[model samples]
Target: MSHAIGAPLIWWVSDYTLANESALIVGDDFGSIAKVKLESETGLKDIEIIQQNNQQLSVRLPATISYHSHALRLYQPDLKTFERVWLNAPKIDWLQGDMGVKTSTGQGWLQLSGKNVDTLNLQDAFLINKTGKSYSLSLKESDPWHAVFNLPKQIPVGSYQLKFGQKVTQPTIPPLEVFIVNQPTDFQQRVLNIKDFHQSEDSIDHTIAFKTALADLATHGGGTLYLPAGHYRLSNSLFIPKNTQILGDGNLATHLIWSKIDKQESIALINLEDNTRLQGFSMYHDDAAFGINSPSDRVINNVHIEDIVIRMSAYRGHPTSEMLTKIYDQILKRFSNKLDTIRLQANNITLKNNDIYGTGRSFAFIDSHGINIQNNKFYNGRRGWYSFSGCSEIIFRNNTITGADLMASGGGINTLGNKVSSRNLYFANNTLGMFNGWDREAFTSDGGGASYFGHVQSHKENQLLLATNLRSKGLRLTPYEGAVLFVVDGKGVGQYAKVISMSENLVHLDRKLDVALDNSSKIIICPLQENYIIVNNTISDAAIGIQLYGTGLNHVVYGNTSIRTGGINLLGLWYGGYQSAWYTLVAHNALYGSANTRKFNPTRTDLHTSNITVEARPRSTDELNLVYGIVIRNNQLYQNNGVSIIGSQNARKNMDAIFVDPLDN
Candidate 1:
């Protein structure tokens, strides 16, 4: 039988049998004529077939085409033999020169040339072999229809019949046969000593081999490309492919070192693009960008760059404000406007137990989402880890950071580069201990002033999930320290913060000379117009608790107990162009320290703010400036320090900002 591709499935043969002098056939009758035949003299005569879909037909006939007309073959699956079932059984447009002539067992011919695979309803297919072996049929490889990741260790080798989907619209595909070759043992397959085989090993040569190996596999039929346990010196970039696994001997003895000592930007070592994995072996690349920069598309899944030590090549940079500014801009633009990058898709991206240090910029970064840098260490470098690429609910948790000191250069865990909003980021149980650099304390510094004033730039986007990770005692800030949760420059002017939920995390900043200069962090920048919420937490051993100065508004600071025995300084409240802060409220608190603790003597504490909530007993210094929308209302007040609120020299006046207490309380 012959059929055209893309034809619809309309009918099927139900039953056929011969009783003495008559023949019977039954099935659905679409519109096409049915045929029934009896084996007596000439050829098939009258055939009875169910042409219409969803309808049945029964017929009685005789021996020849003269007596009957057409014939429907009695088809059934031979339990012990492998068979292919055609989807949308093709039409016998015109049968010529009898091809299927052995007419005994009723082995009828089924055409397969052309048929609309869609209407055939062919899905959920399976394959069976002559020896009773079977394999399931699946759709194209994709994130939705992922490949069978788990391969059976053993299977018999031979031919198999691929069954169409196990549904009404199922069609059998040309059965594909696969041979499972016995892979050699790890020891047997190991690449002998790499050094011994070295012939001036270069990066480009290795890269060429990788590209060639991948091309050969695809062209000559795909197979596992292996790199047995042994060190291979590489000096160039390596390109990988989808639907392919670049396997290496899963041994520490297996290593790949970058021999190319010079390149402005050497590509990543192992590129496990679109949901791939690279387990085993140790890769060492210092001063490079990313060990792996996960794929962009969500469909491109599972990019894991694990069990590797990525060392930033120790190089010298100008380490000036201008240089830092340039690098910061680069990072920000890279991680903007991305969606929920599932941890599974961009997750388990462990920078764990590996060493990433001394690079021109950052160690490792997840510019998109889902990254964990735990149990990792950093040495004499800029930042251990950094990212602004929409990390909406991810962070650096439980990682030991040693050389946290800023090299008169940068800080640790900097995310001040992001301008667009990144939601729900978590930073739990991380330690930023004793270090030797420029900025010691671990915090984020906003990328300040790229174009116009700080008030118009994009705001920082991070919904931080801060957890307790002692950053005290061992942590030291030389050039300038003190205060943990801080930002030096306010780049994202209008960028509002989610919140910094705090509990048990010790933060200490050394008060270097001119504490005010290093005190830059105390002020949280509301660049254009961003708000911050600080709650029940211990903010101590620092110049101040929190500071704000910019065009941002409606920032509420409360529940924070400031133990600043060494005086508490504040920027009262200022309203600049189009960036006037409305409803700025501060209430409920305990400010108990020495007279000196009150930095601004005769300060202005009496305050007012509009439509906002402020409750709790209070204490502390400073007076207040009459600023509208400044509402100060609520409970207990203790021994005060500093001005109740100060209206210092050259201070401007504000409108109807009132202060009131809930008399009921």
Candidate 2:
């Protein structure tokens, strides 16, 4: 039993809802955990417990074990967050015994047992954990279902595997993420001020001083170029250096106005190459603006971009020949490799808590290896975020953009490339304007949302002052649930949550995946991009949930449910080419149950679609209905409208193949 009172109490069995209320009551046993075994789909999802109350003690069943469609051989204290794994041998376990073992991977085996060695075959399965470690049922005398696992100190970030056999595969870019550090072998913090450098009265030779500052930043001996609360006009460009910080006085009054004449990102652009940062400054450009723009391979990696605002060039239409030539000569010709916004050929870019606006024919673009654009706002812009050729891995969490319909442009977050396992992108807790887009948009089953992983809230964790003022105190927004059954870590350590908790949580990889269901990381797509698995995620304000472009084979859309204009619109799988979309199982979950929200259909205002999306603004609870799995079951549908098991030609070819039992209620 659970109690919903002053504190919180959790129970193995409880009820959950989709309202703005607490799903499960967290009683005084706040830290207590418990384990519950469910046989059917609906039973598995009967309750909506946010966290575990009592420790779950899972004792292995006596000996003989039966094979299942998808077994919880390895516990990943996360939501449907399993490391993609292909079994090399038939799984082995016990029905009811002390324990039976199955060699799941090279280093690990599914340890199943109870009181005896070989006897009573168990009926159900259970998994639990903390961080780095996972194992078979917890059979300790005192506790049964839940047992917290210990994790490493500085646990390695990024995705790894829990092999079920003897293969060591990898993702799109196991490309080493090398953090370019400062010179002298160690990181030394240097600080500069507006008084340290300035524009000459004539503004000519003053440009020389600007070059000196730029050269210093380009070199090593990392330092900060601090600007007090005043406007420093630059006749030429202000350059960026490696292992350095260009800081501001932390006042809204602080301003750095770039020479609009340098619109081509010449004097206005900030170049980076390993270990670079830009903090606390309002960059006002006359023509166009740039925060950090480096050449190919040259990047500002392993750094932070906090409390900054960028204003782009606002030329009405075209520029004068002189201005264009000057722009080309001063900017383009110099660094044509640089894109419209910034270019980090091969680096890790984290753009957090910043304000960016680009009107006219300008947009913010990225050409990096791993890019994280989070907790930011965009006013009136032609484009917001884009993932061009070189970009393979990306994460966008808690960001908001206003006028996406100002100009005829591309997507808000465009992640497209022909490369395999290309972009391991992530989108959580982000909000987007529904009826907004520069181009004529199309409506689909989902809201405009197609972001990789869905979540709630459109905000980011910022510096101290911002944190104090920005985040709401006692409000816990809707987030990913379910699948935390595989507890990787406990309260702290390297505890990763379920990756597939969100109805939109999906993982697709060429290699076998063995991850915790409750995870907060990116997914692979092809060797260029592939590992994207979605589980119990929610998406009410989206147009389309999951859209597959190329061949989707052996892909399982397990336990993912969403809502938008229609329902889920499956693409590409129909026609050939990438029709390799096989073994995809979209099972036990909820879909658009909001018949009323359908009212937005005829009155739907925003409809522009993009690559991937999620709800940014903080919401009451996980919105939408109670549908699950990519394979919609006939019996499940019957629960709502009692329909018979039937499939169309295309549905039989795609959905039916993945569906194991459509008739079973």
Candidate 3:
């Protein structure tokens, strides 16, 4: 069969011979084995090709190999034509887990055991559902004889085939069954009706009865507290305890209206503790109060807030032109002290399927981790989301954000503050629309601080002599080792080298410099962080589509469509005395810049006035900044005001930025 360019042709294993530690392979017409690769469940390793022919190849398998499923991939010298053949498939053993019940946040594990199971390449393994949807499985734990696979969350509850290479294992004997329940199992029973208490909508002091019911549930083991369909007035905050579930009839049916007139102090209407679930209710606020707060004390963790609607306005009556004007002037103005709709400080929190409207800030995460905010909607807010301090492993996906006002510094999403660094933060498959805010940029991350730099006094034999003043600029010997250093300005511009070692005033690199360096040359170093993916998103009608400032590593932004907006903007700043935002891939995006004069006004005219801007310059005049390993390719930019690729003054001096088919207008 003829294959497309760069496509690997499938070659099935016709015969296999394993004896006396020697291996023989027979497959369809591979021409010759220019190179051979052995893939096991644990890892992939190159095998020396001892013999080769048009239809047969032979090599010595690893001594550790035994009755386990393995794969042999053959490649020609051109490295384009290849074939993957599974070996020792029939002798492998698969261990299936028992039928299990998993919550939406739960995980499933399946095991496989065989001889030399530790040698398997688990990264290449996957689970295929009956509908042909495949989910990649990771190696949860492994020993020499056995390996466990953690099922991905994207896999739904169904029968699936455990596949590694060409070997597929069907469900065995009892048939593995998995069911994913949306709500907690304890919430299914033991409901406390709020009406049973003496809480009424007419009462101005409704906190007394509501607190009584909450304390009553705390006295016993916590369960679901059911709020019936009614307009419930709250004068003060509601504190939720651990293991408690607060469920209402529906978002529109059950209303929790905040009538508190005190604007001096801020408070959360519902302060959640660990393992708490709040859902199916509409929260209305008048004064500066947060709708929900998940604080980061050790007592609070694993919180789930979903199926709720939060509105910043208190007037439940129909809106009139005068009322909206009063709201815009009195409530949402610059002087208004409105708090965020949700302030998340806890870990392992999921906010899903929620609606937030007309708030100062929709969501904020401070020093949190493992946060998944998905399938939500935000409208008429000041800011869509914010992450302060350090956060990791956070995801914002499938959310629709629109109609944000510029009263406060309005934008779609942002991360900032002192010592703020975010790793593994992904924004995927989201739709952002028509953001009219003071800060017109849709997305931004500002790692605020001075950039780190060291002067290269001289270069000799893969070593660059650093100036003595490097230590004064926060350059430490230990951390400088193994970090990537870029030569900014001078003859060595656009050249980078990895630090192999660092001495008192000299830095050794992995390779010798092709050009000599003078005292005027500057070097910038950035650390390594891993795994950030932004894909399949649509953004429109904003000043800037996406912006990353001084904080990113191993990040990918691909397969997105931006309409009538400024293209992606990247600014590498110095944050906490370090250079961040390196190793980024921006590709396969369709960006359409706005031609409208009012919408496409330049925010920073000092920089290049272009649709797509990448800047890596000094924070002030004295400091130095750098962005490394940025690849921008395969992108379509239409009506971009005749400028698609524009770098600031010193930004293009450090790295060779790649722009393929950058502009169409």
Candidate models: Cα lDDT each: 0.33, 0.35, 0.59
Task: Put the candidates in lDDT order, highest first.
Answer: 3, 2, 1
lDDT, candidate 2, equals 0.35
For TM-score, the strongest prediction is 3
Off by over 4 Å in 3: 1-185, 188-190, 199-205, 261-266, 296-299, 314-338, 380-389, 406-415, 455-530, 573-580, 593-610, 619-625, 640-644, 647-652, 657-665
lDDT of 3: 0.59
User: Sorted by TM-score, highest first, which candidate order results?
Assistant: 3, 2, 1
* Worst 10 contiguous positions by lDDT, candidate 1: 95-104
For the record, the alpha-carbon RMSD of candidate 1 to the native fold, in angstroms, is: 28.9
The TM-scores of all predictions, comma-separated, are: 0.37, 0.48, 0.62
CA RMSD per model (angstroms): 28.9, 19.5, 13.1
lDDT per residue (tens digit) for residues 166-197 in model 1 = 33322333443333322211222222222333
Worst 10 residues of 2 by lDDT: 93-102
User: How well is each residue in 1-665 modelled by candidate 2, as lDDT tens digits?
Assistant: 13222222211111111121221221122332233222323333222233332322122221222322211121234333222211111221111110111111112112221111111112211222234342323222211111111222232323332222121221121111111111221333555554667645655334555567656655646666666776766665665666777777652867766554455555335665566677788876655445456654344345457788877654434789886556545544443423354434545556778886654322344445555566886544443323344343444556654444333222332223322223333333444333233331221211111222222222122100111211232221123221111111212111112223222223222222222222222121112122233333344443344444333322223344444322333332212111222222334444443222212366565533322211111112322111111233311331132222222332212221122232332
Model 2, residue 354: distance off in Å is: 1.1
lDDT of 2 at 118: 19
**C-alpha displacement of 141 in model 3, angstroms?**
24
